[model samples]
Target: MSNGNNRQVIRAEIKYPILAIVVLAAIFAFTSFALGYDQGQLFSIVVGDRAYEENFLHELFHDTRHALGFPCH
Candidate 1:
């Protein structure tokens, strides 16, 4: 019936906004961690302990981290 169709439409519309919010939140968390907290631990899974020594992400985001007051050094 018409009511069922409307309910389906409402559910569909709600799903998209919820999905968008979840996706955006995930992106924000990832960016925040990468720029503010990452210090090679993420890359270490592939590169081994050398990543910790090299600190690739930390070096890459060095200036931004300092600007954001993350205290890299």
Candidate 2:
């Protein structure tokens, strides 16, 4: 790969995964405590924003998934 292509891939492999972890951690933590242990409520709150929530959900579900042994979009 050319230098620019290599750099782009490297950056994507690092940045999106990290962002996914942070977001997932925040999601878990908030669902665990900040929302009084109510997962459904938390889900509701998160989904309440409708458009914003759906977009976030898309980013979460598709682009930046869990930070595990997998690739994120």
Candidate 3:
């Protein structure tokens, strides 16, 4: 009877996932800051008093914004 299970979580497995999460979080934060509804004006363009698309970043990354659960119209 031998109970010698030498299974350990590899550093790469842990690190890579954490790294990816951190990178994604940073990107999401940046995008939110740059194009969120509250502050979208900084990265948006207005025309003729009223424009169809106010947020350029949202329009440019429409699909991604939706996928990331960011409101965009």
Candidate 4:
């Protein structure tokens, strides 16, 4: 006589890929901003050959930029 209960479960493995995507996106965003690209200026930088006079992130986050001493002016 024997009584047994056995069950096997497998969980999907997707967290790693999702995390990688998020990290890459964050890096891209930070690099873009740090290099003076934000809002729609990324397009300009890619399409044109000259540096931009304004940064949309700086303009949009003017108060924050000044508070952080970013020297937007």
lDDT of candidate model 1 versus the reference: 0.87
Off by over 4 Å in 1: 1-16
What's the residue-level lDDT of 50 in candidate 2? 60
Residue-level lDDT of model 2, residues 14-73, one tens digit each, is 446788899999989864442232223335654564644444433544422343323433
The candidate maximizing TM-score is: 1
- Candidate of highest lDDT: 1
Compared with the true structure, the alpha-carbon lDDT of candidate 2 equals 0.48
User: lDDT of each model, Cα atoms only?
Assistant: 0.87, 0.48, 0.61, 0.61
lDDT of 3 by residue, 37-62 (tens): 43345533544323434655556666
lDDT of 4 by residue, 1-73 (tens): 4455565689987656888889999999887476443544665666553324554544666676567665565
The C-alpha TM-scores of every prediction are 0.72, 0.26, 0.35, 0.34
For candidate 1, write residues 1-73 as lDDT tens digits. Answer: 4656555334444345788889999999999998999988899999999999999899899999888899777
Please tell me which model should have the higher lDDT, number 2 or number 3: 3
Q: What stretches of model 4 exceed 4 Å from their correct place?
A: 1-40, 43-55
Better of 2 and 3 by TM-score: 3
Stretches of candidate 2 off by over 4 Å are 1-16, 34-73
For model 3 the local lDDT of residue 12 reads 56
